[model samples]
Target: MTRKYIDCREFPSEMNCTVAISADSEKELLEAAVQHAVTIHHHADSPELRAQLVTLFHEGTPPTEAPRTA
Candidate 1:
């Protein structure tokens, strides 16, 4: 399976967070992302949050900044 990542910089937030997390497996990435969201961003951990985060996953390493739409 391909490595997956989620970059916080890509999302809008009050802190303008710059964290990016990656893992070899989706399960690992999801757990880490959930923890980061709950602890650092003070977001509630729930099914909805997990669903949203899953949609945000990208293959391989995260870009320094969010890629621009063409």
Candidate 2:
């Protein structure tokens, strides 16, 4: 069995989170995401945030900061 690691940075104030999960397969990644959200964000099982976390992980796109035009 191969274990994977997911780098997650959650910001509750911003209502945005960044998660970089790397697993042997998508299945493992999803599992990890759920656990992480629950433990870190205090999201109980079947919470909406869990789904959102999974979606963010699956999307595989990091959050980007907009440039200031000043």
Candidate 3:
């Protein structure tokens, strides 16, 4: 199965976080991403946030090169 990833740098945040989460499935990625969001970004856990995160999900492993901010 293909891996999934969520890059914090892709999202808008006051912290400008550079964290990137990966998992074997979307469900796992969502769970981990949400926890990181709540704990590190001080975001409230909600369905809306979960849905937004769903849109940010990408297939395959995260890039080893630095994330592009522009």
Candidate 4:
């Protein structure tokens, strides 16, 4: 199966977090993403948040460099 990933830089945040996470499966990706969100981003853990996180997941590993901002 293809790897799954979550790129923090894709989301708008005050910190402009650049952390990126990848996993072999969706379940693992979701768990790590959730933990990172709650701990670093101060997000509340819930089914709703979990659902939202799933939407942010993408196939393959995250990019090595941050997107160029204009």
Error of 2 at 30 (Å): 0.8
Candidate RMSDs in Å, in order, are: 2.0, 6.6, 1.4, 1.7
Please give the range of 10 consecutive residues that has the lowest summed lDDT in model 2: 61-70
* Cα displacement (Å) at residue 63, model 2: 12
lDDT of 3 at 37: 86
Model 1 clash pairs are: none
Residue-by-residue lDDT tens digits, candidate 2, 1-70: 4644444553333544555557766577778778776776677878576566555542333334421222
Off by over 4 Å in 2: 1-7, 10-19, 58-70
Per-residue lDDT of candidate 4, residues 1-70 (tens digit): 9999989887677898999999999999999999999999899999999999999898988889885544
Q: Which candidate number would show the highest TM-score if scored against the true structure? A: 4
lDDT of 1: 0.90
- Candidate 3 — which residues are off by over 4 angstroms? none
**On a 0 to 1 TM-score scale, where does candidate 1 land against the true structure?**
0.87
Residue pairs with backbone overlap in model 2: none
Better of 2 and 4 by TM-score: 4
* Ranking of predictions according to lDDT: 4, 1, 3, 2
lDDT score, candidate 1, position 15 = 88
Q: Estimate each model's TM-score.
A: 0.87, 0.47, 0.88, 0.90
As a whole number from 0 to 100, the lDDT of residue 48 in candidate 4 is 95
Shift in Å, residue 48, candidate 1: 0.7
Clash count per candidate: 0, 0, 0, 0
lDDT per model vs. reference? 0.90, 0.57, 0.89, 0.91
